[model samples]
Target: MIALTCLCGQVRTELGKRPDFIHACNCTLCSKSGAHWGYFHPSEVCVEGDTKGYCRSDKEAPSAEIHFCEQCGSTTHFTLTADAVAKFGNVMMGVNMLLADERDLAGVEVRFPDGRAWPGAGEFTYVREARFIGEG
Candidate 1:
């Protein structure tokens, strides 16, 4: 199992299996979140601790909920659409690299997704070097 946690260790999550996809997004909201995006099956994840949800309004006045840690203001996960849970049985978890070890990130793909447009998202820039851990 893969474990994800906040810097202060107040929040923690246990991933049952490896993520289907892992990458970074350049969208306005994501750029400010300060963590890598990891898509996983929700049923396969177990979350602990209190996380504050920030819902972003869309054109229809609906909102996408972004989950962040209240203690450190760290973005740890989010769901852009309600159908996401039904379709993928998964949610996006912002893997806290700071608290993870290098071996924990092995075999994971790191890409830069263009958040300018999502759903039919654009291509990503492949990361040649692994920077998830050992950075702060």
Candidate 2:
């Protein structure tokens, strides 16, 4: 299992398994938060502690519920809404890798996705690809 906590340790998250993928996105929200997302099913993660939520809306997609530590304001992870789950078949959780312990990142590949032009974008322009800190 992989464990993560907010800057103030007010919020925590746990992943039952290694992530499917880890990637940095250039979308507006991602850019602002400076997060490298580690994607997984919501069922594979557990969130604890007091978290404040912010729902971000997009014209082309469902609003996502972003949760952050209420105390230190550090982002923990985000969940896709029920409306999005219906379309996607499951809820996708994007956990912030920055909060993870370096040892938990073993064998994880970090990819870059060009989300700045998302829906209308032709193809992603990957800037870098590498195994994360603890990856062998």
Candidate 3:
């Protein structure tokens, strides 16, 4: 299992296993946060501690919900809204791999998603195969 925590360690999430895939998104919020995502099923994740949530929505894309440490303000994980959840199923969740332990990151591939110019404008791209821990 892999554990993801906030900078202050106030919030934590346990991933049942290494993610099937990891990717960096260039969407507005993602670009601002420089967040790289590791996808998992909600059943495969165990979240502990309290967190504050921020929900963002607009015309360009589906609304999203992000959860972060209440004290340190570090994003721990995110999920889709109700509409999106109905469409995609609540099995999917995205955890911030940037907060995971070093040993848990080995052999993980990092992909780049062209969410900046989403839809017809661009395509998903591969960024790298691995990341150095604490590089966040």
Candidate 4:
């Protein structure tokens, strides 16, 4: 398992397996938070410690509630909202892979999704070509 932790060690997330790929999105929320997201189901991992959850008020319907380490204010992960749960069910969650050591994720593909242009509809397009974590 791979463990990702917040700066103050107030939040810890365990990834049961290496993610196939991680997303570095260019949307407002992602860009501001500076998170590299690795998708997983709740059953696929474990989380410890208290976190403050924030749902964006700008969106008419926010899909996720982003969680951060209450003590250190480190962006930890995000959980789906009730409405999102109705749509995607409980099969999806996002872990902030940035909390993990980059060396621990070496060789994992990192995708740059053009979330800025994503109309909250269909598939995401690439902002740039994908690259592996340890690329020189």
Tell me the TM-score of model 2.
Answer: 0.84
List where candidate 2 sits over 4 angstroms from the true fold: 57-63, 120-123, 130-136
Per-residue error for 77 in candidate 2, Å, reads: 0.5
Candidate 2 vs candidate 4: the TM-score winner is 4
Write candidate 2's Cα lDDT for 79-107 as tens digits.
Answer: 88777778776757899988988677766
Q: What lDDT would candidate 4 get against the real structure? A: 0.93
Model 3's lDDT to the true fold?
Answer: 0.76
- Judged by TM-score relative to the true structure, which candidate is superior, 1 or 4? 4
Give lDDT tens digits, candidate 1, residues 85-125: 55554454345443445577776666666665664445554
Shift in Å, residue 11, candidate 1: 0.6
Q: Which regions in candidate 4 have their CA more than 4 angstroms from the true location? A: none
* TM-score of every prediction relative to native: 0.70, 0.84, 0.83, 0.97
Give candidate 1 regions above 4 Å deviation.
Answer: 58-63, 80-99, 117-136
Model 1 Cα RMSD, 1 decimal: 4.3
Clashes of each: 2, 1, 0, 0
- Write one digit per residue (lDDT tens) for candidate 3, span 1-136: 7877889988889987998767777778776665678888789999998888777655555556888889988888888878778877787888888888757887776677767666534555433344534365
Q: Which 10 residues in a row give candidate 1 its minimum summed lDDT?
A: 127-136
In candidate 4, where is summed lDDT lowest over 10 consecutive residues?
10-19
Candidate 4 per-residue lDDT over residues 1-136, each given as its tens digit:
9999999997899998988899999999998987989999899989999999999999988999999999998899999999999988998899999999888899999999999999999999998999998987
